[model samples]
Target chain A: DAGVTQSPTHLIKTRGQQVTLRCSPKSGHDTVSWYQQALGQGPQFIFQYYEEEERQRGNFPDRFSGHQFPNYSSELNVNALLLGDSALYLCASSLEAGLTSTDTQYFGPGTRLTVL
Target chain B: AQSVAQPEDQVNVAEGNPLTVKCTYSVSGNPYLFWYVQYPNRGLQFLLKYITGDNLVKGSYGFEAEFNKSQTSFHLKKPSALVSDSALYFCAVRPHGGYSNYQLIWGAGTKLIIKP
Candidate 1:
């Protein structure tokens, strides 16, 4: 079965521009989440989508948002980007099975966004 | 404060030696812990997870982690290191309850380098 997949492996944008990154979850997974990994740091949670709606969010600003399609695919959009937004964006998908505690997330290759 | 902590920024070992990456976490309820590895420019890959049952959870790529609830730690380990195993390792945790119950809290990550 296919694992999680992401598009636009790399992109460059100037500050204040908007960008959209996409992700397709692994086969049989129903939940999608986004993360940002700055250089030399672990990923920071962005937000998560379940049943076509955002179920949870992290400390990110309002400029960051996401959507989950019925197919379980997802998109992460960042508006008015800043230089600090330059980082690797990762997508993870899990089965929102019976309970949230048992969910295990699988990650995708990620999109590297460079803000100038 | 970062809920998860990876005290070592990097670790170096001979290819044939055993390897260990330390992680500790603090959560309000029962903790769900995970480990992932990232190769250059690639997305983080899931290694293992400990939700319940066995304290030692085996995952992909011959990696395993021991969950110590008393110590609030989940440390990744391998019987022997390989040159191919060199990569960045991350530890993440999710508490059982809260506003965002299923969101993962991550560490800063630890780089592992194995010399042949």
Candidate 2:
């Protein structure tokens, strides 16, 4: 009964650099979503992937992107990082969206990103 | 646009005292509300959600939230507080339609401090 897991507990990058974070969803879960948490702020949704396709996305700019593997693992890629990009990148997993199942999402420990 | 509001930036309660965290939401259709708690340097953990049916939803760590549709509120509550309960609490909303329907609209978060 493994829960959601993320890789690289922390990372440091510079301006205009790109960074990739990984996430393995909880067992029995199929959908994966990404979020960004700035200092002292709540998380903001980035995007969600299901069936290896992006199903939804937030108001983020084009620099932020993601991918979901067939095994339900996911990766969040951010290009041209700025100082404002320094934040905690969180990964959450949930069931397929619909009325038939509960939509509760389980999260991972998250990776702290520092844009130097 | 869907949104959530946590009016209180912080809440302080004595150990063994009752606690409450207020939340309000703005959505077009039936609101799907959720409560999550985050510890220091950690990711958000699901507390409970109100999709339909009972307004009183009980969740992890003795946490409970009441969904008041008329007031557009979902406030978290507990009979007695513990020092371990101190953390950051967030309220979120799930939109019913559009491309971002599966995404969550997050609040600014409220820090709960239970004094021992």
Candidate 3:
């Protein structure tokens, strides 16, 4: 059973440029969530996708958006990126429980985005 | 407001010594807590979770957490520290009843260094 997987382990972009990070959830998982972790900080919730629709979002702006494919894979798109966007973008997957209170999220290696 | 806090920025311990990473949380109702670890340049790994039963929850890599309802704390503990166990430890809490899209509230993270 493969765990969550992400692509483009590292990326570089300049301010105002756009970037897309990808993630494949673990087998048998139906929900995907995105998070951003800056240096020396804990991860902040970005948003969560369930049944191909955004079920919940955090305090992020409109520039940060995501999509969940039919296969349960996900993509996080950041538009008009800024230097402050340089951080580790993490993707986590979990089984879709009616109540996620007990769900444990499996994470991928994450993409390191460096916005210059 | 729901939140998690890792008061210590970093913790240093000698190999073979037992170690503990502190975490405290505040939420409106019963708190669903979790512990995750991240190695250098890697994604966060689920260590353990606390839901309804068992105040002491054991997880991967011989990690365990004790949930104290009175103190509202869930502290990660290891029997013996290993250099390989050194990593960034994070504490997270699921909002009461997972009503808010199951987004997790995270702490600032604590860097653990096990000296060999």
Candidate 4:
């Protein structure tokens, strides 16, 4: 089966503009989570969606939002993008909402966002 | 709050030599530890996880990680390094049990380089 997939492999946006990145979770997965990875840094969790509702969120500001579709696909939206927003946006999928300690996450190729 | 730290910014090793990437974590209660690797322009790929059971956990791509509860450390190791294995490695942790959300706390990442 196909792994998690993300759209807009590369995107360029100007400051003050908004952008939306899409993701299709792995087959048979339901929960979707978004992460942002800046240059030379590990990914920071943005938020997680389950059952078409946001289940958990990280320390990110209100500008970063996400939605989960019925098909378990997800979209990450960032408003008023800044130069700091330039990073690799990754999407991960898990089998369930309340993950056990052993639950593993599968990731997508990610979308590279460049804020110009 | 949960957090992870990859002490080394980068590690260099020769091909055919063993390699190790160090990681330490801080979390309330028991921690679920994970290791992920990211190639250039790609998302993070899950390598291994430590929930309970054995301290030494083997994972994909011939990677293995040792979980040390007393030291709060989980170090990734490979028997023999290859040039193709060069990439950014991340360590993450999440609290186990008792109202713990499955949100992961990530480190800044460590870059591993294998020379021919």
Candidate 5:
């Protein structure tokens, strides 16, 4: 089965602009979670979508939002992007919303966003 | 609040030698710990997880993690290191017995480099 896939492997944006990243969850998976990975840091949780509804969110501000389609694909939209937003945006997929401790998450290749 | 700490920024080891990446986490209730590996410019890959039962959890790519409840630590280990194993390692944790509402808190990541 094909793993999680993300679109626009690389993107360049300017300050105050907007950008959108896309993700297709792994086959048979229904939950999608977005994460931001800055250089030399681990991925940080942005938010999660299940059943076409946002189930949880991290400390990110309102500028960052996401959508999950019925097909389990997801899109992460960022408004008023900043230089700090230049990082690898990762998408992870799991089988369900409430995962057991042993449930492993599969991640996409991620979209590298460069803000000028 | 949940948090994870990767004590080392980088770890250097010789091929054929055992390797260990240390991680500690803090969260309310039982802890759901996970380890993921990331190659350069790629998304994170699932390594292993510790929910309950065995303290030593084996996962993909010959990786294993020992969950120490008393110490609140989950350290990734391999019997022998390989140059191919060199990559960024992350530790994450979420509260147990909770819905997907709890986000997975991640560490700063540890870079492992194995020399020939």
Candidate 6:
């Protein structure tokens, strides 16, 4: 009954650098989503992965990409990181029953990213 | 565009007092509303959600939300606040039915400070 888990509790990078954050979704979940939360702000949606393909994405630029493995784990990759990209990267998992199903998403302890 | 609003930036209350954090949403049709809490340096934790059924939905940590359809509001409530309840609370929304989009529109978040 393990919940969603994320790797590298914290990370530090510089401008023009790239980083990858990992996420293992909750047991019995298949869909994974990424979000960014700045200090004192709510989370902003990054993108969602279902069936090993990116299903929907938010307003984020192309520098942000992700991969969902067959085992339902996910990895978020950010290239050419900027100071603005320094924030808490959150990973959430949900079960996609259907187009109309309202599945509650469970989140993992976010990975804090600091772009130096 | 579908959006969620948490009007208050912060709220302060003494322990043992009742508390409320407001959330409003704008969506084309019925909305799936959710409430999540985040402690300092932690990720978001699901509190409660409103899909269908009763207007009064209870969730973790003595939290309950009343879904008002006419008002398009889902306000989180607690009978008695505790010092440990101090944290940042977020409200999120997704348009219900007729769509495969699982993206959740998030609010700016409200900080709650429960003084002992």
CA lDDT of each candidate?
0.90, 0.91, 0.92, 0.90, 0.89, 0.93
lDDT (10s digit) by residue, model 4, range B1-116: 56788999999999999999999988878878889998887788899988889999999999999998899899999999999999999999877778848778899989999999
Instruction: Give the per-residue lDDT of model 3 (tens digit) for A4-116.
Output: 99999999999999999999999999999999999988999999999999998999999999999999999999999989999999999999676644778889999999998
Kindly give the stretch of ten consecutive residues in candidate 5 chain A with the minimal lDDT sum.
A96-105
Writing each residue's lDDT as its tens digit, candidate 2 over A16-45 gives: 999999999999999999999999888899
- lDDT string for model 6 (B38-75, tens) is 99888889999998999999999999999999999999
**Which candidate would rank higher by TM-score, 3 or 6?**
6
DockQ of every candidate structure: 0.75, 0.67, 0.79, 0.75, 0.72, 0.82
A5-58 per-residue lDDT for model 5 (tens digits) = 999999999999999999999999888889999988878889989899898898
Highest DockQ: which candidate?
Answer: 6
| Candidate 5 share of real interface contacts | 0.83
Please name the candidate that would achieve the greatest lDDT relative to the true structure: 6
Q: Judged by DockQ cut-offs, is candidate 1 incorrect, acceptable, medium or high?
A: medium
Better of 3 and 5 by lDDT: 3
Find the candidate with the highest TM-score and give its number: 6
Better of 3 and 6 by lDDT: 6
| Candidate 6 off by > 4 Å | none
Model 2: CA > 4 A from native: A97-101, B97-100
Model 1 is docked with a DockQ of 0.75
Ranking by lDDT: 6, 3, 2, 1, 4, 5
lDDT (Cα, tens digit) per residue for candidate 2, span B49-113: 99899999999999999999899999999999999999999998887643337878899999999
lDDT of 4 at A45: 85
Which pairs of residues clash in candidate 3, taking residues 3 or more apart in a chain or in different chains?
Answer: none
Candidate 1 lDDT tens digits, A40-113: 88888899898999988888999999888989899999999999999999999999863454878999999999
Q: Against the true chain A, what TM-score does chain A of candidate 1 give?
A: 0.96
Tell me how far candidate 5 lies from the true structure as C-alpha RMSD in angstroms: 1.4
Specify the CAPRI tier of model 6: high
